[model samples]
Target: MIIANISIPLLGMVDTAVMGHLDSAQYLGAVAVGSIIFSFLFWGFGFLRMATTGLVAQAFGRNDTTLSHTILLQSLVLAIIIASAILILKQPLSQLAFLLIDSSEIVSQQARIYFDIRIWSTPAILINYVFLGWLIGKQASKAALVLVLVVTISNMIMDLVFVNVFGMTIDGVALASLIAEYLGLITGLYLLKRHGVTIKLFKRLSSKQVSLFNWHWLQLHANIFIRTLCLMFSFAFFTTQGAKQGDIILAANAVLLNFITLMAFVLDGFANATEVLSGKAVGAKNRSQLKQSLLLTGLWSFVVASLFSLSYLFFGQQLISLMTSITDVQTTANNYLPWLMLMPVVAVWTYLFDGLFIGTTRSIEMRNTMLLSTLCCFLPAWYFLQPLGNHGLWLALLLFLAARGVSQCFYLPRILRMY
Candidate 1:
């Protein structure tokens, strides 16, 4: 799981590195802006994955193959509906996204090119999410790893070919992603078949069962959607604020954010394990199993996060230089390396707790805690620390992460009691 999750961010690092080495920072800034827009758009529907994982994990724990299969179909149906809507509304959505973001003219133009091409992959990306969640829920870690590797590795290779070899710019990166997602979707379906998910499972479900849009599912997804939206908003706000500081800061911040993304995805590998194990424990009503799973995953998460911080402390500048050859962007990124070094430990708890909550299907609490963190913690911190420039932005983000973990701690007792 750790190896699989790390590959996810390596794709982004490749994209950044490809653009960062170009003659101008605009290319890097364009990719960053376009990526943020999609993060807001696609990740807003991240409930497709999280909700499916929690629900399917519980079903697997109960040894209910039928219910787990039903959950996957339901998630796929939802993904199709959402993806179709995005395609239909792509034009207005693009306009609205650019309006909300305050990027420079050159960056915005290039970002639009990236967005137009990449938006076509919506269906593949969303369906891939459902497949991933289902695999994780079923404890098919190797299958899940294979699915992710197929997408990310393919994307990375094409990124090099299209950009470096063909000399295509932002469009090449976008095209690579578009092609890779469909490949992933195909691979996901093949894995599902190998894992005993067959067309017969679909045949068995009645019309009412096929339309699994029940009140409970809707309510669960609504809470997770809100939670994910708030999370995306924070990152989007961070990116927009950096853009306001000019292209150098925007490009430099983009480079640094790859570090944060890499750390988050690595920690999330443990969290993914926690989600499956914790969900199974809940379904089985085994308190000891739940506690043991959390303890082990929590310990490993901290250890890994600490390693990230140490690596950054000792080799941060070299990493910055490696990502971008531009001396100005490298120097600017180096100036903020300390904040990157501090992020892993401070943010690790949020990833751990997020896993616990998702595994248990505690969406309402997740929703409320995220609201508190974003509204009460992050926004307020950024407001007051405006004098600190980019340091203030990084601090606000850190406070947001800390607030989420701390706030989530208060809910553990209630969650355990309910179980």
Candidate 2:
């Protein structure tokens, strides 16, 4: 499960690797902007995965096969509905996001090309989320790993073929990702069949059961929706602000942020494991197991975060050089390189604690913490510090992470003791 979850972010790294080699900074910036837009849009709804996994895991733990099946069914139905809605709103949303970023006309135009093409993958991406969530609930980590690897490898290969071989630019990258997602969906259905689970588990659902399912599912997802929206807004704000400054700054920040996101994806392996193990423990009502899972996961997150920070500190410039030889982009990125080094150290606890809370299904606290972090901490800090320019933006983001971690930490004792 951890491996599968971590691969989600690493896939982004693969895309970065491809675009980083593009000769123009505009191409690199376009991919970065386009990716972030979708990251927030698609991943914003990732509660489908987190919530579905926890609920389904709990059902599986209790040996309620029917409930598990119903959860899966309803989740799929909801994902399809959401995906369609996103399609309906696609044009406006794309325009809004492009406008927010304030990039050069060339960069924005390229990003829009990618966004328009990739928006069609919403259904595939959402369905895959539900399928993966179901696999995690069934404790089929190996299968989940296989699913992610297939998607990542397929996407990477297509990215190269489309971009380098066929001379497709942003649209090619977008098409590769969209096609890979659909391929993953098809493969997921095939694998689900091989598992040979009883369809009875998915049936015998009553209207009342359906109603309860919808209510609880919406409750859980609503909280996550708000949380993810705020988180995405921060990234959007950062990129948008940087774009307004100039294309070079936007391009530089984009490159640096990709490295930061890559490290995050790697560290998320531990967080993902924590989520799976902790949810299982909660389902079994095994208090000791839950504590052990959380402790070990936090320790693991620290180790990975430390290693990434050290790597960036020692080899940061060389790594940037490899990503792009653009002297101006590299020089500007170096100025902000320190933030990447500090990101994991400052943010590791927040990510780990998130896994813990999600596992235990204490989502209201999770939602509230994010609300407070964004509204009380981040926005206020950004408003006050905008005078300092980009430093203010980075500082606000760092504070948002710190505030989230602190809020979760303060609530942990009460949350754990209640159980």
lDDT of 1 by residue, 54-75 (tens): 9999999899988898899889
Instruction: List TM-scores for all candidates, in order.
Output: 0.99, 0.95
Per-residue lDDT tens digits for candidate 2, residues 1-419, read 55665666667766766776778888888887898899888889988888888787777667777677778888888898889999999889987887677789898888888888999999999999888888877788888888888898899889889988998778888999999999999888877877765455445565336653556678988898788888888888888888878877888888888777777766666766777787778778888888888888888889888988999999999988877778888898898888888998889998888888777778899899999999999989989999988888888889999999999999888867865
In order, candidate lDDTs are 0.94, 0.82
- Pairing residues by index, what is the TM-score of model 2? 0.95
Candidate 2 achieves a global lDDT of 0.82
Model 1: what TM-score? 0.99
What does each candidate score in C-alpha RMSD?
1.0, 1.9
Which residue pairs overlap in candidate 1's backbone? none
